[model samples]
Target chain A: MSSNPQLRRAVTPWGSFSWGYSDVGADIFIGLGLVLAYAAGASNFAFLFAGLVYVCIGLAYTELAAAYPVAGGGQYFVLRGLGDLFGFIAGWAVLLDFTIDITLFAWSSVDYMSQLLPAVLASVHPWSHFLVVLGLIGLLCLLNVIGVRESTAFQGSVAAVDVLSETLILCFGFLFAFQPQILIHTMHVSWPSMFGLMQGTSLAIVSFVGLESISQAAQETQRPASVIPRTSVVLILTILIYAVGYSNLALGMQMWHPVHDAHGHAIAFWQLFPGNGDNQGKAVALLSAQIPYYGLLAQFYVPILGAILLLISANSGVFGSSRIAYSMSTSKLLPSVFQRIHARFRTPAASILTFCGLAVVVLIFAALPQLDHGARAVYQRLFHGEDGITFLGDLYAFGAATSYSFVFVALVALRLFDPMTPRKFKIPFNIPMRVRGERVEFPIIAVIGFIGIFSILVFTLITHDIGRVAGPGWLILGVFLYFLYRRNKKLPLFRSQPHDWRTAQTSILKNAGELELMDEYHANLRASDERKRALR
Target chain B: MIRLRTGFYFLYVALGTIILVRVLSFGVRFETITGIVLGILLIALGIYRLFQVTRVRTSKR
Candidate 1:
């Protein structure tokens, strides 16, 4: 094999990505906005701090991803850079994050549509949200089956609109007032309430979920190296739009306070919009217009633009997720049959079906009346508990955190053990000696990600009444399945290797026709790019 | 699309759609079997996916 630097460069700047993944920053805002807008009962300093932490983590990931551009997905990189267990966790987290995000977006779309076409669409078809979300999923799946370009176009179009709206919010929100008295002096954070704030921040963090969207799109990028950094810059800009713009808006509104009636029963206005000087009234009016009643054209557009931003974010989710379905299906994790690309589209048909299908399921679940906050912390009100907060399924916070945390630890461990690995962009870890920062010690940053992720997992899972065994329980299941599947397949692959479609294909080819699908696929790819690049 | 009891698949997809809507309505769980059952369901779905793959390939090309 020729030791061409071009081959080496194939990892980062030399890398390629799908465009759908590249544009996820736009959608991430929507995820964050939905969580921030609908669920801001607390001022989560931990989350804000975590966002600060993720910026470093994001840089670390960018460096590593750029250095090793062809590393594929988050789980794929973690598996290589971290180790088996951590990789599994990363993959699981990425999958879980994507899944939760899809569900949430579908739910949001239902709410948005309800606001828009609330006539026959809402009444005659009470179950219309289910159909609408399902249809949307179907449409996206069809797009994927058609081609990567189409999907990326979808992501790009949505994101372009989002950028315009976010610009409006940032421009206007700053103009409305920094409100230092309200900003700094509204500092009434209780210990328990602080934890609640973290949860809201977690939602803010959700806006960043589609960071993977760009990574996934690496294959389709014109210049993967240039694309990744450019994407990172744009992402930072968007985060500012969300963090500074939205956080200040929430703060200015005195949204942290309780709403009172003539009867003095305190009500909270989460779903309700921002208020006037009442904060509640103005926010509401702002929500109604996406235009501020009190501020400039840009200021007026902040709330309206926020919603528009979220809608765009949701659209990105729709776009990126279908590709994941295609990737997963192509790998045979779902079924090779689903792996078939459309003749002209070069997209996976079955994968698209799986993507949309799962999304619709989650949407319907989200729309359940029990999930909506009616009266009753406990008793009578369906799906209600003694506390007004509906926990919504087995979604333990720790599970979400652990998946990514392991990846962090894995990155650190890999750097220590494998010092000479090649990379495109290494993070600037200030470690004296040891190649003098030539190699970015990503482990430090990933370690931070690890701690933050693990902390969320521990605090939420341990504190919440999820069950005696549920916290450790999901973990045990991941382990048991690992062994059970291993035993059944018995290929002697390394420990904790996730048996997704790509890995399975790699294994099949390595074994030289031992795996049936690999044999067929290899035959088909007689002159494929990978084949041409192989040990000639 | 090679039909495979389209109604059954429809029913299956619809079943998941309907049940997922009410999944949270289940009062707090008291056992490990819930997640375990989910695992089993996942396995079953995986298997069904494999079957669909085989059928789609055999008929398509």
Candidate 2:
């Protein structure tokens, strides 16, 4: 790692700290937090805990990211900090994270649109909405290929809109029209319902997923060490933001009950206004649910505007994953094809297009006639009552949880094993009954990361509507995929071998002491870079 | 490349703010004591990780 510490910078750090912050946004999971807060019937405590888990993990990653701050977030970290096998698992887990990150947003975006265009979208006739979603994806991809400036400019604008719209909504939400009675009545504490909190963790986890940008953005930032430290601070800020917004959203929905688990915490948001909530004025009903609990005119159109802003924010989530992938590709972990720079636009065209394309597929399925169609009926029944889009998102969340567990373990293990490695930045902690110089103890952050992720994963494993068969089944598929990738490529059987006492004492340290580790590693990498440039 | 960086930054944040504001505002009677405890726990954890830095790095694996 010392030999090639800056490899990530070449692929990731765009330039400096300014560039890192300016470029990065939260991930698809954040979007999931919004949708899931409602989906899980999240109350203030639920969102708070869920949000805390996210920010806490973000803090873990924040420190790890500063230490490693490579292209692959958890995957890259595990490989280096742990071993190759766990690294492989981390990589596979990220695939789950990336794929579902794209799919979930695409589906939810389509769902939002369905309310606006029911006949064309909800009727499932010609499936015109599907095509439109696909086309829109293609356009995003094209734009990604066309130029970075275009992509960033558009996402930034919509991001601003997201912040602004929500601010108005929250202000209205906590205002006079907010009747505390309804929320107080619904605040039921049950062990059974805490399962909802576990399920909701998936949503909360979703919001923090985008913090990968901290690693991805390290390349572009002016000061990797300084900026990385601040990213943790920003994560704390983000938690406050999510906790408040989601809690009030739940409170705002006191006027009505959701369609059971069908509506979840999202129903809380949908319940802002008092009315029949019939399917007919559903769009108006959905929008009306947003009638600000504040002033007279505030109730008129603020919710509608906020919804629009959220949908726009969803698009940026797609953009976030695409950009990260592009950076990865350029680093050579992903195919060079994904690394293709729009000759004119100076952006990774192929990666962006792929992201947009997949999103449209999800949108089409989520919106329009198909979900209600007979085949769709059977499919939904076979899976459960929910559409594939939603379940798939849950599956994504499950994969995300499992994968995150690996990260926490890796962090703790690394702290135990490599107790005193040099890193550009460090997180602070204090320990009880410890030596004077050492106020804090080892793996404290690691312990926090482990506890939070483990508790959530335990809850997720137990309580969710995830198919008992499907959840583990997905992991089976992942294992099979790993084996297949291995057998075919003859890559490695022990994806990661345990480093025993002798191995760690001798081989590992011997290798670590290699005189020209960085020089050799970078030289080899530069050769590959030349080859790529030649091909280009 | 540039768009993914700077443009998307504002774009994504602009989008996230809605979720952020909403989540934060949903009033809950939080156990303030609990929160303070958690915050302190985090600070302690932070300081601990920093301490590991000053330890003996040249020690054998």
Candidate 3:
């Protein structure tokens, strides 16, 4: 094997779409239930609010990923635009999300499987469920270390089936059980308090969390400049529709299962979904199982499908964490050990094992209350109630909100600073301006996106008892490690090292086999240089 | 590949139209506003995709 083995450009357009769909789409399976539990009747509004902001973030990603098609994603974009310190922070926050993703989806996967096998339900058999989650994480880590990858065809087929199934659920629910008056009445009567709304909106962003997958896979995508924009736009729309549709359907539909209150009286469907822990993680499966005629067949397959999708998502978490660490290592933000691939496996063994270990530690931390009576007492006293999945969800939302806020800022900064890179797609509604005699299209949407995500961050801090404490704690630990590593390596701690990004962009485009974009970049550089010389 | 791309674009267009018709059939209400907005966005996206596909085909020809 060659010493310098580059990632092959093998991911086609459908592959790119499936890569993103499998990650972002799986979030709703868990997120819908969480939002419904907290947001209640206003769940649709929560999804809409976050979905709009997500659209802005998605657009920013599309522009950046197309212009600078690399595997590093938001971290690379931030490093290019905002300097090293902010880049490390963004990457670290993303790393937090990736770790949470591993444990959270693994836990949810088991919960989905528990739909068929009641023995593994996390709510009832916490220890057993925790053990299963650990086993799954270990399995994923092993598979990743051995460099096992699912084919694009398989992934696409799954995504297609999921999309069709979800659409059918929505269609059938609307046709048979849905009533607009019921939806309006629920929204009016069961509307959550301000704090609940804030928390729900914050949680709603989880449904849109994995947009980074597309940008991460951009480097390996064929004609990423064109394909990324197309796939990303479609992905953004698809996720938005599902989130909004599912929330609306949940509120409007008639109850299919007998939900009982404390007095054994019948309760509403919305009340039952969020109230039950098992149903919350596998909400989509339950929702699908309630759709009249479709429900008959869907009841059998949806849980299995949800479990498969959730497992795939958890595996992505393992894949993503190692890849981001590898990127950070190559950029000198992380220790070189992270970048070192195993001789035989030809994968980043250290990074995979290390992050996977951190994920297990996170799982343990989340499951502490569930595992021990003493810990449960402490958690109940301090944090009100202890739900492992909610704890993980809090951290996931916190990480995504924090990283995405920085990404919005990075988008604006890049538009201002990196004017020479050809952007095939730009976020709509930009204001034309000149900065230091260079023309810049100030991204208005990015500012809006920043405000929206920052608000979610604030909401996460305010509402999530465990997340507010643990999320910042994780960042603090990362910063401390960063300081130590930087000092030991004799690198600047706060400041960025000088990087020739123009040449880097050229190299990236060349490696992606984007000769047209490469030529466009060179031409822009030459024109800018000529103008500079003329001015001199 | 082109046929697959075209099929996807057509599907999006059809999906968008279905969403719009379905939502609008319920009439305009505060509760359904999100559906309306999403439907419009989907239609716009579908149209944009179709336009892009056409432009690429024409350029290739």
Candidate 4:
């Protein structure tokens, strides 16, 4: 951190991994509830499908992050590789996801805690779920503005506990309570149509969305070229196993029973979980309490732990968005106001306040259905009754799919344009392509990743009625703002400066801080020179 | 020096083995397959590390 609100390279490999892990916090707790609502017993397969794409996207990010090693994550990669216009688009899309991350995680944190504390649950009554979620977002925003550092130790501890607890629950639940035959039968019996499965898979992409934090910390990581690859592999595996395993386990437990009213009339679970259109985000707590030996642990520990982890994630989102906004401001992609630091706290107060304000706007649209007659019916009809959390998931999926597709493309462009730049690690299975007297290796993994993620984007458009409208609206507005910024700066909006590997190399070298690492690199270069001399 | 190095290696192996045995025996009774698999992986890694330590020692000699 700097007085001017710049990112610093202080994160170790484990710290980087913990940051990614914790930012993804309790996604399973919320994800299981959402995916099950759509795909029913086939939720496991949905997660499995999304998890496969996540693996591709994760590897693609690792390759890009290692090569560029910048703070803006995908935004910087796309900027250097593609150009400023596309870069702004990518950064703006990610901003959308980060804002949603802040609000959604905060809302779900209270939703999880409400299972334990009746008082917090009661707050959902008066002004609807709006007041509580807004309060949490405001609290997180204020914390960020005041420059409260989220301790890496706290992140690591929470990540370790969550992983261990979930692993235990999965293993015991699978061994004792999970019936493979029953899971298979349920998958068959409640198996959705292809259309339904597609929708569920698109939504399931939300579970792995926050893993991009690993790459976002690339500039902050020690030995990022090696560290990102190591940390991201473990990060991907952890999320993959949990997402797929939990979905199957939830289905096995038959946790999707329809809610019954006080008079015992059957109502849909999604309808009355919060009655006035909010999601039942505490389904994971309830599901855990149903697990045999884990029931007691789930009753006391799960709700509280789940709440803390979600709040941590919400806090990370605020930090992530402000940092990205700061980086963009430095690049001249955003208004210079976003770059302004608080005189007292040395934090990006402008970016924090603006993004939180945007989140508050989204919360209002989500609660539109709770309004009086004319507007209520209109909102329901237009957005299709998507609660705030579910609405956030829709936009998250959209943002993830959009930015990831661009990143995959950026990976290919960087490989082609900067062919001589040293890549410590490359995505597996590259095919050589000769263009303009230069041989560039095109990654087969990135190609597949682009296709898979693009398809998810398309399906997300087709399936999420609200996201299809709102997501494009956000991008169009971003494009409009980008052009305005370019015109004001007297810079070309569409055209960009020619690709220069020297500039890219300079960025990498400027960010490289470790003496031992520099020593090792120089030694390796010297050895290469010696080998050439010997051959001559 | 060789004795001290080998002692640390042996200690590492012993710790890993204890984890392995506990996970296999107790984890099975508790029906946690994840613990058993994770424990076995740790033990294999420990043994590999031990071999590397001894190999380095012998080569130095």
In order, the B-chain TM-scores come to: 0.47, 0.39, 0.88, 0.58
Worst 10 residues of 3 chain A by lDDT: A1-10
Write model 4 residue lDDT over A1-536, tens digit each, in one string. Answer: 24454455667876788878888656777777778777775677778778788889888888777766766888888887788889899999999988888887887887777777756463445264568778888988888787633555577788878876776665556555655445555665777787778888898888888766777677677778878877776677667767766766665543334457799985432223332323457666776776777776766898888888888788778877887787787777998888787877777888899999988887777655554457667767887666666788899889989998998899888888766555677788989897544567989898888999999999899999889999999999999988998899887889874555465455565565534434444564556567658767
**Model 3 C-alpha lDDT per residue in residues A224-254, reported as the tens digit of each score:** 9989998998899889978887888888888
Report the C-alpha displacement of residue A452, candidate 1, in angstroms: 2.2
Question: What stretches of model 4 exceed 4 Å from their correct place?
Answer: A1-5, A122-128, A254-279, A341-346, A371-374, A433-439, A498-501, A514-536, B1-61
> Where is the poorest 10-residue window by lDDT in model 2 chain A?
A1-10
lDDT score at residue A11, model 2, on the 0-100 scale: 23
Q: What stretches of model 1 exceed 4 Å from their correct place?
A: A1-47, A83-86, A118-126, A189-194, A253-343, A369-400, A417-421, A432-443, A462-484, A493-536, B1-61
List DockQ for all candidates: 0.01, 0.05, 0.46, 0.06
lDDT of 3 by residue, B1-61 (tens): 6666667667656665776676677799887787677667656766887788889889999
Model 3: number of clashes?
Answer: 0
Order of the predicted models by DockQ, top scorer first: 3, 4, 2, 1
Question: Worst lDDT window (10 residues) for model 1 chain B?
Answer: B30-39
Q: Which candidate comes out best when scored by DockQ? A: 3
Model 2, span A1-536: residue lDDT tens: 01111222222222222222222222321333333333333434555665666666676677776655344666656665667666666655555455555555434445455555567655353356455545545554555445444444444555554444444444444442344444444443211255555555554555455555456554433344445765456445534454444444444343332343354544444333222211211222242344444334433443333333333334444545555555444333344465555554455556666766655554544443253567656655564444444455455556666667787777665555543333444545623333322222465665776677677666655655553445567567756765665566555656443444323323322332332333443454456457658767
TM-score of chain B of 4: 0.58
Model 3 residue B27 CA deviation in Å: 4.6
Predict model 1's lDDT versus the native: 0.43
Q: Please give me the DockQ of candidate 1 compared with the native complex.
A: 0.01
Better of 2 and 3 by DockQ: 3
lDDT of 1 by residue, A54-171 (tens): 5655665565444334323566556665545555445544554555455554444444444445573432354564566556556555554555544444445545554445544433
